[model samples]
Target: MPPAATTNLGYTPPDGGWGWAVVLGAFISIGFSYAFPKSLTIYFKEIQEYFSISYSEIAWVSSVMLASMYAGGPVSSVLVNRYGSRPVVLVGGVMVSAAMVLASFGTTIMHLYLCIGVIGGLGLAFNLQPALTIIGTYFHVKRPLANGLAMTGSPVVLSTLAPLNQFLFDSFGWRGSFLLLGSIVLNCCVAGALMRPVRKTVQLKPNTEPQEIVETAIVDSRGQLSNVQTDKRKTESQAWLHKFVDVSLFRHRGFLIYLVGNVVMFFGFFAPVVFLAPYAKHQGFDEYSAAYLLSIFALVDMFIRPATGFIGNTKWIRPRIQYFFSFAVAYSGVCHLLCPLAPGYVGLVVYAVFFGLAFGMVSALLFEVLMDLVGAHRFSSAVGLVTIIECGPVLLGPPLSGALVDIFGDYKYMYYACGVFMLVPGIFFFIMHYYNYKKLDEEQRQSLAVEMKTSEEAEQLKTSSDDETDGRTH
Candidate 1:
C-alpha cells in the first residue's frame, strides 16, 4: 500500500527568487499564444483578395482559428494533467511553428484552415493552459500580481506584433512573413524549458510503527496524484472530465451568475473592435487615419493592461476581483454605447482611449477570476469548458453585428446592442457577487462559532479532569 498523502489545506507560498523567473517565462509563453492569432489579420486582406472571397468568408479564418484554440482546451488540459507543463509546452511550441511554416506553402484557403486554424491553434492551446497553470503552482501569496504580470504579455505582444506583422508583410509578402513568424514563434520552446517543476521535500515522522509506514507520492498542480493510500475512504466523486473541469460549476451559484453574464457580454464584446476601422472609413476618414485608430487602441491597451494588473494586484482589489471585473465589463459597455456619439475623428479617438482601458481591464481579469473560483488545480479543465461554450459567441459575434449593419445600414444599433449586452452582465455580476460575499461571510461566521464552541468544551474537560485527580490524591 502507498503512504498516506499529506493534504495541506492552506498552503503557504515559497520564497520569491525563482518564482518571479517563472512568471517571466509565463509572460513570454502567454504573450505569444494570445497575440499571434490577432496579428495574423495583417495577412487576411491579402488572402481575401487572392481567394476572391467575401468579408464573411475571410472572417471564417479568424473564427475557425479562435474556435479551434478554444476547442482544443480540453485536449491541452488532459495532456497537461497527464504529463507536465514543461514537456507539453515544448511540444506545443514545435506544433505551432511547424503549422505556420507549412501554412506558408498553402495554395488554397483550405490549406490555411487546416494548418494555421487547426494545428496552430492547438499549439496555442497547449502553450496557454500550461503557462497559466505553472504560475499558480509557483505563487500563492502574490498570485494576483503574478497573474497581472503574465497577462500583460497579451497587449505587449500585440503592440509589437501588429507593426512587425505589417513590416514583414511589406518586406516579404504573406508567404515569406509566415515563414519568419514561424521562426520567431519557436521562442516558445525556450520559454517552455524555463517552466521547471517546483521541487518539494517531505519529512517523515521518527520512530513510526512499521505498519504505519505507507507508500509516499507527490501530487502536482495538474491534479496528478503520486502517493499511494491504504484504507482509503470511498466516496462518490465526479467523473474525470467533471472532476478536472467541474461542469458542476454550472450548478454553483456564483459560477452560474458569472457564466450567464459573460455569455451576454461576449456577444457585443469583440464586435465593436472588429468594426472600428471600417466605421472610421464609413465616416469619410482616410484609410491611414482609420488604420491608425487600431494602433491607438493597441498602444493604449498595451499600457493599460500592466497598469490594471498592478491595480488588481492591490490589497483592496485582489480579494474582490469579481467586482473589479464586473465594473470593467460595465465600463466597456458604456464606452461602446457612447461610440456612436463620436461625431468625428476626435470623438472616435476619445472612444478608442476608453475602449482600450476597458478592454485591458477585462482581459487581465478574465481567466484570473475563473482560477479564483475553480482553483489552480482545476483551472485547465475549467478554461477548457468555458472556452468551448464561449466559442459560439466568439464565432458568431462579429458576423451577427455585421448583419445588423446590413439591415439598418448604420453601426449605431450594433453598438447599442453590444453596449446593453455588456452592461447587463456587469449589473448581474455586481448584484450576484454581493449576495455571494454575504453568503460566504455567514458561512465563515458559522465555522468560527463551531470552532470556538469545540475549543471551549475541550478546555472545560481538561479543568474537570485536573480537579478530579487533585481531590483523589488529597
Candidate 2:
C-alpha cells in the first residue's frame, strides 16, 4: 500500500509548468503515430508499379496498417498500465523504426503487410495510447490546450513528411526511402525519452477528532488509476487477454453512447481524405496539383487544431467540449454532402478548407471528450475499447467508398455517402449527450443528498451521546 496524505476538497490545478514540455514530447510522438501511415502514400504508386499490383490491392497495405494500429491498442494500453508510459513509448519507437528498416527489404506485398502493417502499426499504437495518457497526468486546468497542441502533430507531420517522402522516393527509390524513413522515425525515441514519469504528492483530508478513518487505498499510474484496481479480482484469475482491457466498458452508458456514435462516424471520417487526391485527379487535375490538395488540407488542419484547442480551453467552451466535438462531426458531414456540388478545382479548394476545419476540430477533441466522459481513471481501458471497436469502420470506410466509385464511376456519390454517414452520428451524439448530461446531473444531485443525510444523522447521534453523558455526570 502507498503512503496516505491529507485530502483537500475543491482543488484546482495551476495548469502550466513542466506540463507544457510534456505536451511537446506528446506532440512529436502523436505526430508520428498519426502521420506515418498517411505519408507512406508517397511510395504507394512506386510500390504498385514495382509489384504490378492494382490500386485496391496496394491500398490494403495502409488498410491493414490502420486496422492493426487500432486492433493493437489494448496490448499497448495494458503495457502502459503495467510498466508506465516512458518504457512502453520508447519500446514502441524502436519497433516502428525497425519495421521501416525491415520493410526496405520486402520482395512481396505479404512482406510489406507483415513488416509495415503489423509491426509498424503496433508501434504506432504504443506511441498513441501512452502519449494521450501522459497528458492527462500532467495537466488538468490546461488539458484542452495541451491536448490541442499534442494533436496538432497529425497535420504537422503529414504536411512535412508527405513532401519529404516524395523527395526521398525521387532520390533513392522506395527501398532507399524506407531506409532513410526508418532513421527519421527514430526521432520518436527522443520524444519518448522526454516523457518522464510524473511524481505527484496527493493530500488527504484529516478527521475532526481522533476517530479511525478507514481509507480505501487505490494505486494510480501517474494520476490515473491502474487498470488492475478498476477490474474486480477473481479468486482464480482469468487469462491475461481478458484481463488486459476491461470489456465491461460496453455496458457503461457513456461509453456505449460514445462507441455507437464513433462507430458510425468513422465510416465517413477517413473515406473523404482517402479519395480527396484521387477525386481531384479524376477531374483533370495534374498529379502534382492533386497531391497539393492534401498538403493544403493538412496545412489548414495543422493550424486549426491548435486554434480549436485554445477555444476548447476557454471558460465558455471547456466544460461543454462534447457538444463542440459533436458539432464538428456534423459539420464534416455537411461538407461531404456539399462536395458533389463543386463544379471545378476552385470549388474543391473551398471544400478542402471547410473539410480541414471540421476534421481538425473532431480529431483534436476526440480523445479529450472521451477523457472527459470516463475520467482519467478509466481512460486507458476506454481508449483500448474504443479503438478495438472502431477498427472495422477504419478498415472498411475507404474500400466501401471506393466501391461506390466503382459502381458509378464518379467520386461525388462516394462523397455524398460519406457525408450522410458522418452527419447521422453527429445528430445521434448531440441527442444522446444531451440526455447523458441530464442523467449525470440527476445522479450527482441524488448522491449529494445522500451524503448530506448521512452527515446530519451522524451529527445527531453525537449530540445525543453528549447529552446522555452530561445527565449521568449530574
Candidate 3:
C-alpha cells in the first residue's frame, strides 16, 4: 500500500522518553556549535593587540572557524551514520576543548588560527550536524517541536555567552578565558553522554522498511568492454561514495529545490544581524542603545523558535510547513527593506521584534522541513550535503553586505541587498514546492490506480484456473 512508507530503521520512533533527553543533549551541542563562533569575537580586539595583527587578520579567526565547521559537514555526517551521534559528539567535545586549552598557550596569531579556528571549528562542525541529525532519527511526529526547542539553544547560548565572555575577559584575560571556556565546553561531552543510541530501547515494528536510496553503483553496460577490471574498480569506488553521501538525492526533486533555495537564502541570512548594531550607531544612536537592539533581537528570537516549532507540528500547519518557512524568509526580507524608513529608536525596536520572529521561524523549521521532504531515514545525508554547499554563503554574506556599506556610505542599501537576497529565494521556494506537491499528489493517484488494476487481474487469473481444474475433475 502507498509504495511502502519509509520509517526509521523499521521501528516507529519512541517520540518521547529518552528522545527528550537526546533533545537536551542536542540543545547543548547545537548551542555551542552556533554560539561559540559569535561569542569568540569578544576576544578579537585584545587578541588583535596581543598578536600585533590588523583588524582584518584578527577577523579571519572567526571566518576560518565558521568555514571549517560548514566544510566539515560531510565528514561529520559519515561518522554519525557509521558510529552514531554519541561517539562523534563526545569526540567533538574533546576536540573543541582541546582547541581552546591549546589556544590559551599559543605564541602567535597562526597558532590561534590553527587551534581555535580550524580545530575548534571542525569540532563545532562535529557537534552541529550529528546533534541536528540525531533528533530526526528519534522523533518523527514531534520533530518540529524537538527541532524548535533544540534551535532555541543558539540564541539562549549566545545571549548567555556574550555577557559571560565579557566577564571572563575582564577577570581572567583572553588566555585564562580560553582556559575556562575549554572547561565550560566539557558540557558537550555530558550532552553526548545523554545521546545513548535510541534503537536499543525502541520496540521493533513490522518488517517492511522502505528500500534505501543508497545502493551499489551501476556497472558499465558493455560486457565486452576493453578494461573490465578498471570498470569494476570504478564501480566499486562509486558505490562506496554513494554509501556515505547519498548522491541519489541529487535526483530527488524536492531535496534539490530545498537545497538550492537554502544556498540562495543564506547569502542574506546573517548579514542584517551583523550590521544591526553598526546601523544604529550610524543613525546617531548611542553605543549602549545600539547594543540593546541585539539584546532585543536575541530575546525575541529565543521565544519565537519554540513557538514556531509548536505551530509547525500542528495538524493544519504540518502539511504546509514549507510555506510557513518560505513566508518567514520573505517576511525577514521585508523587515530589512523597511528598516531605513523607521522613525527613531522606537521604530528600530519594532523592526527588531518582527525580524527576530521571522528569523526564529525560519531557523526552527529549516531542518524539520528537510526531513519532511526526504524522510527521516535520508536526512543525515540531506543535511550534510546542504551544509557543505551552504558554507560559501554563510562565510561571505556579511563581507558582501559590508561592501555595500563601504560603497554607499549608508546602511540602507546593504539592507536592501540582503532583503532582495532573501525575498527572491522565498518566492522560489513557494513556487517550486507548490509544483512539487502537485506532482506528488498526481503520482500517488496514478500509483493507486495501477495497484487496483493489478489486484483485479490477479483475482481473474485465480478464478479462471480454479474453473479449469473443476472441469477436468468432472
Candidate 4:
C-alpha cells in the first residue's frame, strides 16, 4: 500500500514518474510475449524437415503455444493476485527461458510440445497479463498514449526478431537457435526488475461525521477492487472467483459487446499474418523476399501504433474511441479484401503498409477500449475472462485459413474469407456500440434530471418549514 504525503492525500497515479519505467518494462515483456511465437515460425521449416512431420502437425507447435497462452489467462491472473506483477514477471522470464532451453534438447515432437507449447506459453501468459495489469495502475489520463506506446513493442520486436531468427538459424541451426533464444529472452528479467510496487494511499475528505469511503488495498499491479461495497452477501463461489478475477463483468453490457465482437474479429485477425509469407511465395517471390513482407508490415505497424494512440487520446476521439476501433478493424478487413489485386512484390509492399496501419490501430486500442468499458479496477479480471474465451478463435483462425487455401487451391480465397470474417465483426461493433452509447447517454441525462428534481423538492420543504416557524413566532 502507498503511503501519504499530507492529510489531503490520495494515491493518485504519479502518471509520469517511475510509471514510465514500468511502461518500458511492460514494453519488453509484452514484446517478447507476443512477437516470439510469430517470429519463431522461421524455424518451422527446418524443424519439420528434421522431425519428418507433415505441415498440419508442425503448425500445431505455434497454435498450441498461442492457445496455451490464451487459456492460461485465469492462471496468470490468479498468480498475479497472490503475488505481485514484479515477482510474477520475474518468475515468468525464468520459466520461458527454461522452457526454451529444455526444448533445445528435444528428440520428439511431444517434448517440444510440452516444453515450448504448454510451459513456454504459460510463461508468456505470466509476462503478458502482469505487463497489461501494471499499466492501469500507473496511468489514467494518459492511458491511451501509455497503452499505445506499450503495444508498439509487438511490431518493434517482430521486425527485429524476424531477421534475427533468420540469421540465427543460418548460423547455428534450430537447436542452437532455441538455446540462444532462451538467453535473449532473459532480458524480460531486466524488465521485471523495473516493476517497482506501487503503494496506495487513501485521500479522506473531511465531513460532518464519518462516512463510507472507497479505496483499493493495492494500487500498482492488480487493482481488483476500489469501490467500498456494503453488500457482503457474496457467495463463497463468487468470493473465490473474485479472489483471482472479477466474474461480475460477465453481466456488464459493454463488456459483452466488446467480447463478442472481439471473438468474431479474431477469427480473421491472425490468419493473414500467418499466411502472408506463404501467399507471397505462392505469388512467385523467393523465400527471403517473401519473409521480408512481415518486416515491411512490422515496420509500418511500429509507427502507426503510437500514432493511433495519440489520435485516440485527442479530445475529439477519446470520448468515443469505440467507433475509432471499429473503423480500424474495418480498414484491415478492406486491406485483406483488396490484397488479391496486388500483382507483385511492389504491390504487396503497398498492401503490407496499409495492413500494418490498420492492424496497429486495432491492437493499440483493443484493450484501451475494454478498460474504457470496465474501468481500471476490474480490468485485471476482464482481461483474463476475455482471453480465456478468445482462445478458441485465436488458436483455430490460422488453421481454418489454411484449410480454406487447401479447399480453393489458391491463397486469394483464404484472403477473401478472412476479409469477410473481419468485416462482419467490424460492422457488428459499429452498430452495437452506436446503440450502447446512445443508451448510456440517455441514462445519464435521466439520472441528472432525477437528482435535480429531488434537490428542488428538498429546498421547497425547507422553505415552507421556515415560513411556518416565522408565522408561529409572530
Error of 3 at 23 (Å): 0.6
The TM-score values for the models, in the order shown, are 0.87, 0.90, 0.92, 0.88
The numbered model that scores best in lDDT is 3
What lDDT is reached at residue 255 by model 1?
66
Compared to the true structure, candidate 3 yields what TM-score? Answer: 0.92
For candidate 4, write residues 1-474 as lDDT tens digits.
Answer: 122112122456666788899999999998998998888788999999999999678878888888989998988888877887999999889989999999999998989999999999998998998899888878776778889999999888877898899999999999999999999999999999998977665545565332448884544433234222323344665797788788788889999999999998999999998789889999888998987888888888899999998888887788888999999988889999999999789999999999989899999998889988888767778888999999999998988898989888999999998899889889998999999999999998999898788778777877999999999999
Q: List the residue pairs that clash in candidate 3.
A: none
lDDT of each residue in 139-225, candidate 2, tens digit only: 676778889999999888887897899899899999999999999998888888888877674645576433558997666565446
Candidate rank order under TM-score: 3, 2, 4, 1
Which predicted model would earn the best TM-score?
3
RMSD of 3: 4.2
Candidate 1: where are CA atoms >4 Å away?
Answer: 1-10, 200-244, 460-474
Residues 293-314 of candidate 3: C-alpha lDDT, one tens digit per residue: 9999999999999999998888
For each candidate in turn, give its C-alpha RMSD to the true structure in angstroms. 7.6, 6.8, 4.2, 7.4
Off by over 4 Å in 3: 1-9, 200-236
The ten-residue window of minimal lDDT in model 2 covers 1-10
Q: Which runs in model 2 stand beyond 4 Å of their true positions?
A: 1-14, 208-243
